[model samples]
Target: MSEPLVKEYSNGEVTIVWKPDLCIHSGICLRGLPKVFNLKQRPWVQPEKANSDQIVALVRECPSKALSVKGVRFKEKDNSDVKVTLIPGGPILIKGGATVTERNHKQVHRETVAFCRCKRSRKFPYCDGTHAQPKED
Candidate 1:
């Protein structure tokens, strides 16, 4: 596999790192912080529009893990106890550094992974945050 394309936007205090290849185009970032993440803008991400804490919080909600924060290191915790949470009509959030393997026996290596629940994701198995969209009657 080749190296993923990474773009970084800075606001002096913190930097927002975006990896396009990893992004499934989930609109979570835009929904979470419209001022910072504008799709129509030349540079979609404007980190300066918001503070570091707010930015980091929104980044964590990114279903694809494409949006990440730099300059802030979260302290590592003992991940012996894993947690699988259902995001209330959204995806199934798996945390605690668990290993996920596909039916084909391929192991998915990631700190966390969001499994699709509503079953409307363009990217199957993983959530692209499509569940947040309004249902068609």
Candidate 2:
């Protein structure tokens, strides 16, 4: 297996782990906390801008589960109620946690996941933010 491309940003108390490959670029992080998740910034993520608790709370809302804190696992509940959100031109986000079975027969647990609807994703079933890119004629 290939190593995933990941970046880490720390603010002493908490460290944010970013998995770009897993990100659907829904902009939830950027929109929710621009002070820390500015795209125009050099490193992109500046965890120092917000308190650790605030960052953690926002990261937990990431539908793609791309943004997470080190040593922290997503808290799961027994609620079977799931909610799906369709992002205008992006991936379909499914929240409320579920067990996703991959084509390889691997069962992965996730609090949220993004599925590609545009069919342009190189990641196949999963959205990798390809729908947001310009189409080539």
Candidate 3:
């Protein structure tokens, strides 16, 4: 079988593992804790950003299972195929081949997909460039 695409990190407080394949790039990690999850840097996970408790809580909030924590004895896998893009004021753009199912009985076999996070897309689940609108702040 192929190798897993996950990475692990720890700072004596706790150990965190990241699975890029399952990541939806919600920006929760970076937004919640920029000190630890810096996308601008390579390897992108700084165990020192926050304590294990805080990190665990934030990781759990991820809509996707991109972030996970467990005992220190677990091993991290390699994540080379996972591509995470940070869209400005928009949902994350994931690039890969996966099965997507909708409530309208439509199944799309696509290589790329963009999810909306700004919550202003007229296309519902898909992004329709609604994030370009100004927010009330």
Candidate 4:
């Protein structure tokens, strides 16, 4: 497969880093703050439309590592502990210094993994944000 596309949108204070290949299209960013993530608009992301703090919070909730915030970092914490968050109708985000291995001990992402719970993701095991796509009407 080809390399994933990484896009960046900025409000000067903060930039939203988007990785389309890793995205599960959960729509959390758009739903949480439409002004910044309106799909109807050109470029789709308007980081200037919202405050950096709000944008950062929403991006952290992205199941896939697709949406991430730049220009912000928290004080060092004990990240040796693993963390997981399940989206309402999407993937499960497993993060924080994790070493994921398959049954044969083949390694996957060392720190983060987004597992598809919806079973419709073309990307399989990893989420491609397919859950966010509107079903055919």
Candidate 5:
């Protein structure tokens, strides 16, 4: 197998390297920091867009092992049954063959679910343009 493309960014304190081939394109990086991880750009992932702590947090959220902390060793989980995605400013999207039981409904389906995090969503349990809304100072 060929080596994956790795991009590195640093702000003197620490550096972050991203492996695109391993990435699932969950959009977590871009959503977390558009100024850095602009998908529309030729070379995405600008470390200067955010601080080291913020970048590390977003990278750790990646479901896929695409993003990793530079020089840090970690173990890979067996993710054979679950599908994970890191959406920008949105909930981590998860889908695939799974079972979800509700109050009166026990459904087994292949569907995508978006979990909310911004907390300003009109659509609870999911994101609905809430992240785009301007925040009040």
Candidate 6:
């Protein structure tokens, strides 16, 4: 019910927009371009480290639509297939434009999303990186 958190990182030609609230921490960005999406670093995103084209390509791979480039339009994924993947210790990743029904009976469609399986996320159905944190007894 509040505004989603958005952060921007620019390399002049390309400006990467990040919506943390929509992020599933799928690691696609990190895995594709570690130099630009390093989690160990402060700010976490360093668009300046990579070329604009490279950055844009990786941002497009984001399943949750959490990462985007300013002034750029991403092609929608084909909705013909829906697949679900269960991570070993993380969230459940769903792809291919799946429709989700919330507790309030609101249905939402996502091209790619990660649902919380650890049952520790404050964000309820969505994974907010809480599963990666050390647990306390």
Return the top candidate by lDDT: 2
**TM-score between candidate 2 and the true structure:** 0.59
Tens digit per residue, CA lDDT, model 5, 26-92: 6767766788679787666677768887877777777786887787665664667678888886677
What is candidate 3's lDDT per residue for 1-137, written digit by digit as tens? 99878788887878788888898876778877889899887768888768877887777767777787875332344545657687987877877654566666478876777878877888878788888878666
Q: Against the hidden true structure, what lDDT does model 3 obtain?
A: 0.76
Candidate 1 pairs with clashing backbones: none
Reference-based TM-score of each model: 0.54, 0.59, 0.51, 0.53, 0.50, 0.58
**lDDT comparing candidate 1 with the true structure:** 0.85
Cα lDDT tens digits, model 4, 4-81, are: 788999999999998988988767677789988988998999999989889888887777778887756544445657
Q: What lDDT score belongs to each candidate, Candidate 1 first?
A: 0.85, 0.91, 0.76, 0.82, 0.72, 0.89
How well does candidate 3 score on lDDT at residue 14? Answer: 82
| Model 1: per-residue Cα lDDT over 16-115, one tens digit each | 9999889897677887899999988869999999998899888877878788888665554455678889899989998876676576767778778899
Error of 4 at 126 (Å): 22
Clashing pairs in 5: 31-88
Give, for candidate 2, the lowest lDDT window spanning 10 residues: 74-83
* Residue 110 error, candidate 2, Å: 24
Candidate achieving higher TM-score, 2 or 6: 2
Q: What is the lDDT of candidate 4?
A: 0.82
Ranking by lDDT: 2, 6, 1, 4, 3, 5
Evaluated at residue 71, the lDDT of candidate 6 is 95
Stretches of candidate 4 above 4 Å error?
A: 71-137
Off by over 4 Å in 3: 72-137
Candidate 4 has its poorest 10 consecutive residues by lDDT at 71-80
